[model samples]
Target: MSREEAVQRVAALIKGIKFCMLVTQTDQGRLHSRPVTTQEQDFDGDLWFIGGKDTEWVHDISQRPEINLAYAQPDGQNYVSITGRARLVEDRAKLEEVWSDFYKAYFPEGIDDPNVQLIHVDTHGAELWESSGKLASAFALAKGLVTGERGDMGSNETVSLE
Candidate 1:
């Protein structure tokens, strides 16, 4: 596919996946990853996430914004990786736009809570693979039978690195 097509496909995949691993850098320069719920992206490719202001990751991103995000299906046969830089946005209006019931479980007080913070991950680009995107399960199964690999699996990723 053309580069533009690939980029659009990647974004579509992102819209389909709700959870991702947000990777961030520690002070010692080591990488750390945590599961986070992804909300939406702005026109400039800025991804939105909600977290606590005093969280380790919030602090990490403050010092190191370079990051990556990953997503995949349950079967582990499909996955995507997104590279981005993150910055904190204090816009309550933006959070209001994306907040959902899932987030209510974490923040009963909602987006206006003093502890809540917004993370805007600036997506530079992404790469993806879906084992069943083409309905090629039978073919993949045959290949796996020969190669001794597993069946359809899914993964989605969003991360940060030093």
Candidate 2:
């Protein structure tokens, strides 16, 4: 798919998913993942997240900027995996723009909290899988078993955002 189309598709798939697993590489070269709140905003090859400057993930990102984000909506059978580079940002304006009241739970001092920080992810590529629905998927599997042929389970595509 075209780059623009690919980005849009990923955006649509991940829309309204309040949380995603942010995966980063630790100092030991092992992978670490944590659930983080995804800022409510339009996706445009860039993602914003709220985090703590003193967090382990933040330290990992400082050493290795490469990261991955996994978004899934099991009920809708849509999943997206995005590869990107991340960095800690101190953009006060952006922090305010994406700020939500729910974040007060983490940053009791509001956006002014000294530990509050922003993570900016510049995505380069994504892979997405979309299925029709639970019923359709079940039918496809049954058909495959009966006919001894591969059934059309869904559409899976990998696209470049860069």
Residues forming the 10-long window of minimal summed lDDT in candidate 1: 153-162
Q: After the best TM-score superposition of candidate 2, give how far the Cα of residue 107 lies from its true spot, in angstroms.
A: 1.1
Off by over 4 Å in 2: none
Which tens-of-lDDT digit does each residue in 89-154 have in candidate 2? 989999999998898998889989999989999999999999978899889999999999888889
lDDT by residue (tens digit), candidate 1, 12-98: 666656688988899999999999987755223567888888899999999999987877765535677888889988887887887
- Name the lDDT value of residue 18 in candidate 2: 93
lDDT of each: 0.73, 0.93
The CA lDDT at 81 in model 1 is 81
| Every model's TM-score | 0.75, 0.96
TM-score: model 2 vs. ground truth:
0.96
Worst ten in a row by lDDT for model 2: 1-10
